[model samples]
Target: MSSAPTPSRSVIHGDALEWLAAHPGTPGASLLTSLPDKAELGLPIERWRPFFQQAASLCLQAVDEEGLCVFFQTDNREQGRWVSKAGLVLAAAAELGVPLLWHKIVLRRPAGSRSMGRPGYSHLLAFSARATVPAEASSPDVLPELGELPWSHGMGLAAAEESLRTIRRASPSTRLLLAPFCGHGTALEVANRHGLDALGIERNRKRAERARGDR
Candidate 1:
């Protein structure tokens, strides 16, 4: 059997957007990240569009022509309105002229108890500076979402791992992975698990430390 990918070995404590702006990334690097949910930021959804646009722009600036960006996001509904974080990111990518390669659904089964209109799914969006190459194992358009692992409220480890695998399968030439809003480093940990070089930036010091602990 093939050996497992290398471990995620680095973590940075800072804001992802700022970090991206301060330190440029090499070409062919892949970005795997999940921005803070709309509710978590305590900001109105109306204010999120510009923020995501600037964030995407900074990330695009860091990568090369062949770089790929994989975004993991879920719905955030408040007061009966579902806020589409993925949509905003997509718009941001389009604004930057990045071609949207593919988008996949991650289906989740409700645990504990069910509520009215609560969704049991998330989205994984992939974009590239240019066209992307598909992999045989990465052809699935929808994947089963993984269970949460002691998560304080972020992307699931299993889900993140599978998404990273898919991204790598599509772009095997990508050498490094960047996560600007790494939150708790789920993406970074998954990157390391795949033995890919990765860097994660989180503004929350505690979350950043916890991300390292996940390793």
Candidate 2:
């Protein structure tokens, strides 16, 4: 028996927005990313809202027509009011005429749990301009728990796996997984482990190096 070939992986330290702008409508590629929140960006909610929408729009634009752009977002409270990152993504997708393929909820904490800061559940949403998900391809809308986290801000291992599986089933032709604002490259590692080529861009040099598994 022959061994399987290893998948290719690349981690670039740069601005994700600039990269997305420079390479719009990337072919044979799908996106899996989490946009920075107000806390990470050091911006007030007023400023961060528009920035988040713009980033989401850019990510949507960068995806191939038949490819999916998946976002894993956690809702947070600001000034005693809840902010919905998934809603922001939906707004951006609507602006670009991209239809939502699926929206799944991943639990950060067990049901009936209470949290004071971030919500107990995170949103996993997928969008595509030309691709449609078949009825037979449907998966659970709610995942009971997040498997594990490489970092506080990293996407959970279980969630990442589910996202990739959805992409593989919905868009079999997708060969590359593009992750912007990749943090420590949780998604990149997961993608490569599952036999897909991975490319990630992070502005933080240290995080970029870690994403590349540098020693």
Candidate 3:
């Protein structure tokens, strides 16, 4: 039998907290929402409280010992901070060692917007994390994506893959789809051509202009 080295973990997370807090109450995530499982290290998920108690608690201890969660979502701490609009919660947990469950979500505006443009979208790769578990949280059947983008690189990509890897082993029937149909031109065509069953959503029209970056 061959044994391979274990992969490093990360989470590619967006500042869901910043985006959601921008709005008082938005139904998109407000109605029947809960914490999600299967969070990757590079890309932080929507900060589902109580649901991620185990990981969140561990994250708090790591932050307390290391001065920060080391979210691993991005190299640019500033950009990641923008996504982790609720950094204070994580910071508090680190300081007190008492985890605090978060509001479950903090959404940002769509990509390519400045200062909560749509009040529900953002381009920053920030994080929305919690320290404790929530009573309303539930486990997700499928792994969630960070920034919900089409790129296969960066902290988010690393994070997503890590989560998917674990999930595949735990439940082989569940599959992870990347960059599901988000780009124009040969990108989507390529996904179809390869029979890889690309998984991503691209509602933004400007994505068409990003043909050069498509792989």
- Which candidate leads the pack in lDDT? 2
**Inter-residue clash pairs, candidate 2:** none
**Number of colliding residue pairs in each model:** 5, 0, 33
What TM-score does each of the candidates earn? Answer: 0.83, 0.96, 0.24
Best-to-worst ranking by TM-score = 2, 1, 3
Question: Candidate 2 — worst ten consecutive residues by lDDT sum?
Answer: 129-138
Which structure is stronger by TM-score: 1 or 2?
2
Please give the distance, in angstroms, between residue 83's alpha carbon in candidate 1 and its true position after superposition: 1.6
Which is superior by lDDT, 1 or 2? 2
Provide the lowest-lDDT 10-residue window in model 3: 26-35
Candidate 3 wrong stretches, greater than 4 Å: 1-157, 176-196, 206-215
Model 2 CA deviation exceeding 4 Å by range: 1-4
Candidate 2 residue-wise lDDT, 16-133, digit = tens: 9899999999899999998998999899999999989989999999988999999999999988999999999999999889999999999998899988988999999999988888
For 1-215, candidate 1 gives per-residue lDDT tens digits of: 99766655577887777778876656668887777765577767678766766786777667656777877777667688777877888888878788887888777664444655546777888887764765556566777655575565577776777767766777778778887777777787778767788877888888888777753
Instruction: Provide the RMSD of all predictions against the true structure, rounded to 1 decimal.
Output: 3.6, 1.2, 16.3
